[model samples]
Target: MKEQSSRKGFAKFTTLDIVLMAMLAAANAVMTVYLSQVNQALNGLGGPIATSTITGLYMIYGLLAYYIIRKPGTALITYGIGAVVQSFMGSAYGILSCFAAAACYLIIAEAVFAAFRYKNWSLPVMMFTGGAMVPVWFFFAAQMFGYTKWGTGVLLVALCVRIMSGILLCGLLTKLLGDALSRSGLLRRFAVSRAVES
Candidate 1:
């Protein structure tokens, strides 16, 4: 009876969940490569501020997967897979940095959802989760890229921009995309589809 119950519980993550996670991770890997070039161009043009504006886009895929899956460990697992995929796909930041970035995102995302017991999928919750994920990676990036020398005021401004970008581009965009997918019936078997219907 215990073994049967364990199997039933483990069945929460179905084949579709694995496929969706893999697809999103691959997509994230591709986007990461493309965005690295964009980041370089923006950095040259308007410095950190310009590059920070698109920070949220870098984080969306994992959040979108979490939003759709509405499951514990969704962000972490997707991000881990994404890091592996990014490393193999020729990330500009190289292999270690790709995994580092994924680690930073998953840590915060997992904490936030776990705090809510992974039950709340409201817009505010999503925005908070997205915005909250920014600072840790930003700190690491600042240290790595010598952004600390840019003066405190500039660093603060860039951080703020990144947070706002996280809220809008990652959080809001995930919600919108999840709802659209749910409405189109593509996510009918996912928890998000039922949430949307209710």
Candidate 2:
């Protein structure tokens, strides 16, 4: 009986779910290579602040996958697959950094959704989730990229920019894209489409 219940629970993820996650992960991996060059140029132009502006874009795919799937482990699985895809795509951040980035996103995204019991898909909640994913990874990145040496004021400004970017680029963009996809009837079999219809 217990094994049957477990299987039933796992069955929540249809094959479509797996396929969508893989597609999003692969897209993210390819985008990461291009974005890294953009980030490098931005960093050169305006320092951490400029680079921070696009940080949320790096996180969008996993958040988008979760928004569309609305499942407990959606972000985690998507991000994990993204890390693997990024490795093969030759990310400038190195394989370890790619995995680390995914891990960072997984931690915050899972915790935020789990905290809400994975039920609240409201705009505010999504924005909060996106903004929340920034800080912990920012902590890790500060040390790695020497952002700590940039003085407290500069660090705080950069952090704020990143959080806002997360809210707009990652969270808001995910919601909008999900809704658009839902409307197109392409996501008809997904949880998000059901949510939209009801």
Candidate 3:
């Protein structure tokens, strides 16, 4: 059946789709700047923190994008694009590493999704993807900004923050955005496929 064979029908994205993705990127960029400021303000208060964890929230954007689009490049494109937007908006992470981390997110996500036939769509996997992207961000940060300030406890602090941010923020944000997209009829394409599968 032509209807059954139409991949486009299952996920037909338009200008609105692209625009929405870019808007999300901008929103995420603004969020990062705000979060960083908050982190800076609370540094001396010792609110149980580490090197830098907002990168976890950064990955959340990809999670949400991929979840909604259910497309191969959605995670990669949106996030990479987001970073570019973030840099132009004056991100502390800089344009280069933001792009690098975005590339890593996209690549890792593609591999993960492929392994699952692109149908697993589970929370754990989302967290794994988020965590996987952590090093890219941290390493980039360390290289560009240096972690000497954190002293002898840098590794422990960085890893802990990675675990917390990746597992919690990215995964939760993905679930939230995915749910919202489904409710908005944007995921109708998925519904058609599942109905036939059942």
- Name the best candidate (by lDDT): 1
Estimate TM-scores for all models.
0.93, 0.94, 0.77
Off by over 4 Å in 3: 1-13, 51-53, 148-152, 184-198
| Predicted structure 3: lDDT | 0.68
What's the residue-level lDDT of 173 in candidate 2? Answer: 89
Candidate 1 lDDT, 1-198, residue by residue in tens: 999976775578888998999999999888887899999999999998999999999999999999999887788789999998888888776687788889999999999999999899999999998899899999998887689999999999999999999999999999999999999999999999999999
All candidates: CA RMSD (Å): 2.2, 1.5, 5.0
Task: Name the weakest run of 10 consecutive residues (lDDT summed) in model 3.
Answer: 189-198
Better of 1 and 3 by TM-score: 1
| Per-residue lDDT over 151-174 for candidate 2, one digit per residue giving the tens place of the 0 to 100 score | 999999999999999999998888
List ranges where model 2 is wrong by over 4 Å. 1-7
* Best prediction by TM-score: 2
What's the true lDDT of residue 65 in model 1?
94
TM-score of 3: 0.77
Model 2: residue 194 alpha-carbon error in angstroms: 0.8
Model 3: per-residue Cα lDDT over 39-74, one tens digit each? 776665653354355547767877677766566667
What residue pairs clash in candidate 3, if any at all?
A: none
lDDT per prediction?
0.91, 0.91, 0.68
